[model samples]
Target: MLWPTNYTKLASATMFTLFFAGATFAPKRMVNGENIQHFLQRHYCNAYKYLASRLRHLDAVIGFEVMNEPHNGFIGLKDLKAYHPTETLGPR
Candidate 1:
């Protein structure tokens, strides 16, 4: 996939990248006294809770899963500002 043109536009740009940056990219600390990963997780939990509260009474709605296909966004990279991956492959 083509890399995004703007890397720092986290809120409205690529969501998967944002998920990685917010959820799992480490050196886990606080920005302005807020742990962003936990903040993101709390939002997910709250959404699930809201859905469960509304749907638990129904017989067919049997389950819920959060963080579907969670990705390690930029977790192991040695450099943050440079595009490192040199290749991409399509269906063979």
Candidate 2:
């Protein structure tokens, strides 16, 4: 299963887009006073449930890096907010 460089990059980008595109349309509500940990736990639980059902055949995907260069700014916030408004840190 050796994919060519361009193919690998394209595949990765496509997968990222599909995964995040779903996230973009997810229900959103202001967690008025929720702590970050609590918010993340609740959000992750929902996400895991959905992924478990939708991607059940896939065994597991354990670790994750938030973004390539995640920082508070136009590009960073724009990218993160596009897929995860609830998860984005406020403007820098």
Candidate 3:
């Protein structure tokens, strides 16, 4: 899973595109080889627990946002059983 020091040298110089080639070092726990649904569900559950426990005392606090400006992470047609690329990082 070790990449060359100069990963940018392989693709069009944009390392972001190259990251889709593998799932070795994922960002924000989002990788190519892992299960996208499980990863996002874990994040959501943890966030909900934290908010429900910590903010329960505050009456004004109804809910909390899981993430702000979240990225799509590493997803593609392989992760989802679809004819097109519909494995987006949302309620798909």
Candidate 4:
């Protein structure tokens, strides 16, 4: 009694879809836009600082350029203030 590969894949997909159905219909609030922005900023800042501190004098490691790349998920939560977090609506 072994399931086919496609069957397993479909089953997994269906299960996840079901689990995330609420998110599809409404905001999940899994991530906050401002929090995520700050989190990424802190992440890169710390990494660069740590490396720069250790290897500042090294010629190859003259400078570390930190990129501030942020992503807004499906709900488009970049600016949630106007829409605001509530029982129904979320930032878009």
Candidate 5:
């Protein structure tokens, strides 16, 4: 199915927010009969595998790094409602 560019962008953004920003990946949290943490980890591993397979032949591509600047993912936060600022990289 073909999707409009704007729709695709919105969908991507929504998924990122839901999966990365919002997901706590707690063992108790269940989605579709699987633990959220395990589900996310499985998808991450699958994505890495797909990328590795596609880039394996490329000599220029030495390695792949996923989530280089990893966030805590809302874990062990004292305040759930408080806004925590992320450190900015690069110049303005």
Candidate 6:
């Protein structure tokens, strides 16, 4: 019977390199704040509208994520107004 010798060493080395690299270079964490959801929603909506207009085929893309962390507590009509008194809260 014939056996391949290089495969095991190659796999082991690749795995070790990836593990160490990930440990050494972790991704930056995001900070959460009360008005962060509203801020993100406002900016993303503008961007999405622009993109949809330019790429007419994507007009159906009407939804967006507020943030990776959903601020359910900060996502109410009164809370939104309190955060940005100048801005009016639209339909929920």
Which prediction has the highest lDDT against the true structure? Answer: 5
The whole-model lDDT of each prediction reads 0.51, 0.42, 0.43, 0.41, 0.52, 0.37
- Index of the highest-TM-score prediction: 5
Ranking by lDDT: 5, 1, 3, 2, 4, 6
- TM-score against truth, every candidate: 0.54, 0.27, 0.34, 0.33, 0.56, 0.25
Worst 10 residues of 1 by lDDT: 83-92
Q: For residue 25, give model 6's deviation from the true position in Å.
A: 28
List ranges where model 4 is wrong by over 4 Å. 1-34, 65-92
In model 4, pairs of residues that clash are none
Candidate 5 residue runs with Cα over 4 Å from true position:
1-25, 81-92
Between candidates 4 and 6, the TM-score winner: 4
Quality of model 4 by C-alpha lDDT = 0.41
Candidate 1 structure quality by residue, lDDT tens digits, 56-87: 88998879776543434454546656533323
Task: Please write out the lDDT profile of model 5 over residues 32-83, one tens digit for every residue.
Answer: 9876556767788999999999999999999977864343333444654552
What's model 2's overall lDDT? 0.42
Per-residue alpha-carbon lDDT of model 2 for 19-61, expressed as tens digits? 3442343234225565433554567678867766776666675
Residue 22 lDDT in candidate 6? 23
- State the displacement of the C-alpha of residue 81, model 6, in Å, after optimal TM-score superposition: 32
Sort by TM-score, best first: 5, 1, 3, 4, 2, 6
lDDT digits (tens) for residues 1-92 of candidate 6: 11222222334323322332322232231225323334444566788778667767676766556333222222233543344322322212
